[model samples]
Every structure is written in C-alpha cells, then in structure tokens.
Target: MLETIGINPAELAASETLLKLLISTALLITVVVVVRALSARYIRRNVASMELRRRWLVHSRNGLLLFMLLGLIIIWGEELRTLALSVVAIAVAFVVATKELILCVTGSILKAGAGSFNIGDRIQVKDFRGDVIDQSLLATTILEVGPGKLTHQRTGRMIVIPNALFVAEPVINESYTHDYVLHVFTIPFKRTANWQAAQQALLASANEHCASYLAEAKRYLKRLNEYRGLDAPSVEPRITLQMPSAEEVHLVVRIPVLTDRRSSIEQSILSEVFSQQEFSGAKEKALEQEGSAPTG
Candidate 1:
C-alpha cells in the first residue's frame, strides 16, 4: 500500500504526524461516547427537575459533538482544513434550505432556557390546545384536548407546534402554577322550573367534587395578586340567579374545577342539576334532547 503511494512501508510507519493525528481522532471519539452515555444516564435517573434534565441532556450531547469535531479539525487541520471548510459550506447550504426549522430550533432553546413553558402546562399556541408532554429543539409536543368537536379518548393526536410561534403568537397558559380553574355552568329553564332548587343542587354537587379546590385557589389567587402588586384578593364563591328571558329562569353556578377533572366535574354537576330540575311536558322533551349533547 505504501509502495503505491511512493513511500516505503518503514517510512510510512515512522511518520509521527500521521500516528499523532490518528491517536487524537480515536481519543476524541472515545470522549464523545463516554460523555454522552454518562449524561444520558444521569439525566434519566437522578435529576428530579424535568426542565433541568432536558437542558442538560441537549447541551451535553451538543457540547460533546462540537468538541470532538473541533478536536478533529485541530489534529488533522494542516491536511484537512479544505475538507472541513467544504463540509461547513454544505451544512450552511442545508441550513439555508431549512431556515424556518433553524429559527424554530433557536426559539425552542430560548423558550426552554427562559422558562416560558414547561411539561404538564395546559397551553394553547398557534391554534393548538393541549397539555405539553415534551419540548424539542424545533418543536413542542402536546397531548391534544378541548378543541371544538374533539373530546375524550386522550384524542391520541400529538400536535407539533413550532416554537418560533412563541415569539410571534400569544400563548394561553391555563395551568401555569395553579391546577384549579373556575368553571361556570349556566342553567336556563322555563319560568315554571325550580330555578332556585336547581342552582342549590348544582352548587352542592360542585362542592362535593371540588370544595378543597376553593381553598387552594384562594391561596393561589393571593399569591398571584401579590406578585402582580395588588391587595388581598376576594376568596368567596359567587353564585347568581337571574331571569334572562321572560319565560326562562337562569341559574349560574360558579365553582372550582380541578384541571385534570374539568370534564368529569362539569358532567357530574350538569347531570345532577338536570336531574333535579322540574320542567313542563314539552320542556322535558327539550331538556332530554339537550342532555344528550356534550358540554365543553
């Protein structure tokens, strides 16, 4: 092999430069593999903080790859700079072809580092609503829920939202720190229906499911108000009764709805309220029809 390259086998064996370059390359590769394995294992086991673990995993992998490539350049640079420059040129060309993706990746890193959103947050961005499952460089994954016409079954649909939208569009964070939301269920029945009785029953049902949430919400609200530079906030539950139409009485029951139990709590309160309400013969048929439909 050395003869074909116009060098004797002994001469090639004596080349210190070639041997040093080969040794450097091998060490660089070994370092990358060892660091990646240790980092991935540490993140998977010991880190209780999800966001920190994610950041560490990403930066660790990228740092190792970058260092290895830099080492290769330094070790074999005298002979390989031209090759390295060509590789860089090709990478730049590929990035230019995927500019949007590059921006999304950059945005995701910024969002993750700045703590814009985290796993388990119920958020809506770019017209998609779901609980965030995980975030990547270019996109964030969501467990789909609560879009008009979609319900239950986990939806099973994963929405990949470009993180760049975080800068361009507004995000709705429903479960930022507090997991309880105030859910208002309004009941309208003919004037003859027992509106007051229905309201009481609905309120009672809500309390059965979420009475503890009210206290938690109060504490959360106080903290929120203080953080926003406000005075002590109201911690009372408000229920209103009204006659929205001449023939109809309206009962609005406002109660705390746990984040995970929103749909269940809503269904329970609605079912109980409808069961307890009294209606006319014709109105009874309409009530049954409405009951068959789903409520958001």
Candidate 2:
C-alpha cells in the first residue's frame, strides 16, 4: 500500500504508530462526549430514583470507558500488554500503602448498597453515634446527637467516618426499621399533687401530638398478635408514672415522632402538658404564697 502511494515503506511504518495513537485519542474523546450527552438526556427523561441513577452512571461510565481505552491500547501495540502488567503492579503498591483508606471506602459502598444505613437514620456504630447527614465514596457524615433526644450536641461538628468501620464494628440503627422514634421525658411532681391526673394529662399530650402514626403502628401490632396468637395492647398512647425519688413522682412521657424530630416532640409534649391551667394552677398558687412570704 505504501509503494502504490509513492511513500517509502520505512516512512509509512514510522508514521503508522503516530496515526494509530491519534485515532485512538479521537475515539476516546468521542466516547466521552457521547456518553456524557446520553447520560444527561436519560436522566432528564427518566427522572429515576437518585441513588439508582448515580449507580447507573458510575458503573456504565467505568465499564464502557475502561473497555474502549484498553481495546485501543491492545490494538495499537501488542507491547501494551506489558504496560497493563506494570499498571497492575502499581495498583498493588497503592493497596499496600493505603490499605485502611481503601478498606473504609469499600465498606462504605457495601453498607450503603446493602441498605444497612441511610441518611436520616439514627445510627450508633462503634463509638460514634448520630443521625446520618450524608454518604460519600470515602466517608459517611453524621450530625452528632445524644441518646436522650435528637439534640445536636456537636452543633458545628460533622462526623466523617471511614466506611471500613462497618466491617470492623456492629452498626446499631434505632430508626432503620422503625419509621417513628420514641422519646421519653421525665417531669417531677410534688408529693401532694394528684399523680393520676398528671399521668392522664401527659398521656393526652402524647396522643395529641403523635396520633397520626398510631394507626399504622397498631396495624403492625395487630399482625404480630395474629402470628403469635397473643393479645396486643391498644395502640392508644400511655404514660407511666413512677416514684424513683422520695420527694417527687416521675411522670414518664413517651411520645413518637421521626428520629430527627425527637427533641422537638419532647419539648412540645412537655410544654403543652405542663402549661394547662388545670395542671399548673395549684403549683402557681403555692409559688405565689411562698414568694409573698419574705425569706430574710
């Protein structure tokens, strides 16, 4: 072919490698553009689940681009097989140097894919405990909250945990399977106040704020009862009054709400139950009488 084109065979061979490289480069560029365009269009039209769409793009791009690039290299030069072997060697060295980081990243992906934890779930893994804020390739982020309520104790701090810890430790998610979280608050009562009335008021407050979720919860309870041949208690909310301390009765108010809203629900239930005129009247009279007497 070179002789017919009035080109020397040596010159043709010299330029052949360069021509192949250029063609391969152009093909790579075309693949990138076309893939990106198609991805954008598909996303626009399908509007699929966010998590599913992201996985789709990542796996598709990695497989397609990697196949094309390797195919081009192999076609251009059989010597490229040696290059692939060298690249594998470098990858092994990297694995050794950043073993922990690599492991964490792998764990994060596996945990997320397995639906072990998700954003908004209250999770306690190893020593770190909080509601998940975000998840990334390398780390999982959380807004630190305590056990009592969904109070953001680490107000400004965002926890970044490497994914590998999931494999090393057990993950406890209080809100993973359950849609509603229960928060218990204790309010003190005077030895003289009507304890039963206080209990009733507290239970009423819990029901007022969280009655919506009770029906579904009761249905689940009903199903469990049928399976076990047991009688499940009524789904209506209840408050337990206990006297752990000598001077006061402990009104244990349990209210149900989403995990992140636990604190707010607690506060609302407390305020409403304690603020009623019927409940506060005697306490107010006692306080007024005490204040009127001078403590000299």
lDDT of 2 by residue, 217-270 (tens): 667657766876888656566677788778778777666566556677777776
Candidate 1 residues 64-148, lDDT tens each? Answer: 7668878887888887765666698788888899988878977876786767767777787766888777766677888888644
Runs in model 2 with CA error above 4 Å?
1-93, 126-133, 143-157, 182-197, 220-235, 240-252, 258-261, 277-296
Q: Candidate 1: worst 10 consecutive residues by lDDT?
A: 146-155
Q: Give candidate 2's whole-model lDDT.
A: 0.70
TM-score of each: 0.61, 0.56
List clashing residue pairs in candidate 1. Answer: none
Clashing pairs in 2: 104-164
Question: Which whole-number lDDT from 0 to 100 does residue 169 have in model 2?
Answer: 83
Q: What is the C-alpha lDDT of each candidate?
A: 0.72, 0.70
